[model samples]
Target: MSEQLAIHGGKRSVPESFVKPWPYVTTADQQAVMEVFKSDGIIEQQRIQSEGLAKEWAEYMGVKYCIPVNSGTAALHMSLTGVGIEPGDEVIVPAFTFWASAAAVLHHNAIPVFLDIDPETYCIDSDLIEAKISERTKAIMPVHIHGMPADMDAVLEIAKKHNLKVIEDVAQAHGARYKERLCGSMGDAAGYSTQASKTLSSGCQGGLFTTNDEIVYERASLLQYFGEIIVPGQEREDQKYNAYGLGWMYRGDMFSQAFIRSQLKRLDKNNSLRIRNCNFLTEHLSQIRGLKTPYVPNECEPVYYNYVVGFKPEEIDLNVSPRTLRDKVQKAMKAEGVSMGLWQRLPVPKQEVFQNRIGYGKGCPWKCHDSIIEYKKDDYPKTVEFIDSHSYIFDVNPPNDLELMGMYVEAFQKVMGNLDRLLK
Candidate 1:
């Protein structure tokens, strides 16, 4: 009786090319990048633009300092160094987040102590953090996964109690907030990514590091530019060639910086659009029996970097694994022209890097430290369950409005409404 499913030669709910690509580049973005090319002092102009963006981002984030970097990974590593994360120190992180959240700790020779996430929020479970704290615990890195801000108040309380630092990984949460406070501003130092697919895209790879502590800022600044005290806008005239310590070439490029500057002007507006679109999807999708819409906490405002949906086969009396049902639904939805896919298939601790204890060559950090901590994948049951059941719906941002959102709802209805046919 239901309309035939798309995979079974039925009419597609969303027409081909109905959903547009991400980032929604504008004419102003092009002009800004072009302006950099036309400048007489290319490097000088680049530095000016890069520093200008840092200032703007720091103001927007309500933080005291911002460092522009080449990538989010670099930003996180700089933050780790800024927080005095010495070798063998353990940094507690959520197991369900992107691997970079843990990899950044390894970059500093610090062991990442993976913890389980809150099943509802998909952020680190603040209640479980204290159990993981130890004598070697240096900091707690909580990733704002999918732009949903972590429980920063609880995290800060735990950090204060344990006398530890909190480094927020705001890579997926550019404009998100927890209890009216910005995600990056609440932490000792936070890292953000301006990668092309991110909410605050730079049209390519870029990153920002923010901190309220002057000491952390100065330390991170040293690590960002090859350990030298090369002041911005000084043209390296006051630069001392002496290497204060080990550092990396983590500077942002001129073109990406210019594009980010142009993009920052619209970040809030774009985030509003994303919030609208995601809210609409949640409203409609939540009505479907087997599909679970994202759960937003009362105290947080997320930017919806990814609109995550969970498959609840048990709710629908389906005698199948959640992953099996999810795979079938995802395929059927794709046939209906819906953009949905999984982000992380495995938990962070389950990844080969951690499973094999591979840290740099020869397991140096793990071996060099000679610590007895173990990374068992089964320790994070919630993260494994979440990954097996949920997938992200992409393009839920600006340049793709309510009409596209309506089509997405229609696609979900058509595909999930006829799951019997889809499974057959």
Candidate 2:
């Protein structure tokens, strides 16, 4: 007989406070932040940490230039602008990703053309890129969602054929690789987030922008510092107060940059642990009927930023929608102490901002640019289905370890074994 669920006054499968917190902050991480405070002047500190992090990250990503910014959205916006995405231009983006992927397009007054993701990878469908390329399309922004690298080869090929620039959204894929090449290195420009929850954390909000083109770097640099060509650590008399072009105060703080630098050192190690834990989960959980594990491609090495699980009602002979079954399973699993949650509830195109076209007020971009593109929610069936059926397992990173993962598997087994009780 299956053990009674904790939801019904039974002992919890996972003990209270068993799962460890993320980012795995250590004594060394603490020291790195403290070092920033020891610097003499604010300007000197900012220059040292910001420039150092840029150099370190640029070298890591095998890119020529990197700019540290305040947030991932800022980095993304800079990437689009760096690649010469002008106002009224159109940029193709995946409908399944975080809204920021598309929001960055609109920040520059460009239109975001949303496309459905591949059911398998949950990333943009490279096979569908050609159909969305219009005369006004200036770029294609392929997001490496949930630490999984998108099909870069096919995306690059299409971009080359159509003469469109590629901007990679590496917000969730810090150490992920495709065909042994790093994710951010293959695109014209890329954006990465070092936000607190991400694989490579800054302990707070932060972002990195990287590209090989000098012109693109220069353009992006201007946007980071109030559109000025001001040099960090330069003499006060030499400061340039001129605004070369429109810009935002997207510069990152010294504290966050230092923390990010410290974290970057262990990114590979953390990613490896995440891979091991996720692999273990898949090995055990794949045996459970009606549960679908993530589908990794042969050419990609994912870091498992999120361990996404899909619930298939049909496989278990459940006469309920996947969403309904997913919610019930999630509730029962929570009672057993498994940490799981849904990230996106709807496709990006179905978001109210797009549905009402309330972009920048009065449908500015659509009205101002006279864009003919429509954001019908039905266009992205795969994204809708994925969102309705799946939930992510959190804290799969290091410091949590395989032991906790084993407990998670036990919890799943217990819950699934007693689905009859769960349905009641």
Candidate 3:
């Protein structure tokens, strides 16, 4: 390794040309998509590909029912709606997750009560949830962000005590398990995303809603298709789409549906490889001072959707902002050919949609509620800290060739060890 920092003219470690995941396309995948195109029924009545995919996914997740939708956001909105969350009802969610997780609450004219996250896991702090619960509290939507399962046992116990519905936002955690129990199967209903870049990518856009409860399944099923009713015993293709009430057109596309079936065959294997790479990265990085590696509880078997590393200003003993040192490290790491950066800059409440109350004219849900809720940027101290610092997320699904991971190890070792030069 060079003594000079990469930014100060040391050689790069990893090669930019090293590709990952190699787009696992097969001849069968090509034929299936091509056939769909030639059939002249892109939006056919049956949606066989979508239905079959949904059924298979149901078994994969160990849920009795799975409803395939156009996107993860749709799955969440329908799930909450199916669970009977109405306007004025409040759902507790993490302030530090993707907007879609909280936005789904807004979609149904409900209020999303954002809570701070557990600093170690970067997930909603189960300890803080009870404080936010109220009469209007209807559900607890715990997102398994970056594929690290949230403390489901704590969340479930809290929900049971308070009579709140539990919705697992498993968009990034396709294969994650908690204490031998699968993630999506733990909550009353769980949502999944198989869009491009997800653990189970279809090279397109898609989502799934899974649940064990029969009533919840039926409700979400009808809600996705404008309240369309399906008669029992009819084949998926022969079922009548009897529309009765208001619903969103959250139907899944045929190509994406068939495309994901190919990806499912490799989802578990892909997750295993990701876990190994993550362990390798963590083992090396954990030795560095002023740097935090991803933390997984003993009970969790994470799929590693993201190997999210953290850098807290308070955790570092330096007087200057951690961002200063973080930038130096990142610049040198990039120069060393290791990609690292923040995923989302702001937590949900800090976004303009929440700050300026600019969602859907008059901020219907935020202000439309009987008791208007006030949002302060500093209310969630931990989430704000995460936004201000803790940048850079590592993709767990690396290239087909595992050698890039070796480069990743070398890159971090070189950068962190050369901090004296980096600070200069």
Between prediction 1 and prediction 3, which has the larger lDDT? 1
Estimated TM-score for each candidate: 0.98, 0.98, 0.92
Predicted structure 2: clash tally: 0
Candidate 2 least-lDDT 10 residues: 229-238
Segments of candidate 1 deviating more than 4 angstroms? none
lDDT of 3 by residue, 120-233 (tens): 788899999999999999999999988899999999999999999999999989989999898889999988987787888778788999999988888887788778876543
RMSD of each: 1.0, 1.0, 2.5
Q: Write model 2 residue lDDT over 1-424, tens digit each, in one string.
A: 4998888788888899988888788998899999878767766788889889999999999889999999999999999999999989999999999999999999999999999999999999998999999999999999999999999999999999999999999999998999999999999999998889999898889999999999899899888888988675586478868999999999999999999999999999999989999999999999999999999999999998999999998999999999988999898888888888889989999999999988899897889999999998799999999999999898798989889999999989988888888887
**Candidate lDDT (C-alpha), each:** 0.90, 0.92, 0.81
Number of backbone collisions per candidate: 0, 0, 4
- List candidate 2 segments past 4 Å from native: 232-237
The better-scoring model by TM-score among 1 and 3 is 1
TM-score of 1: 0.98
Which 10-residue span in candidate 1 carries the lowest summed lDDT? Answer: 231-240
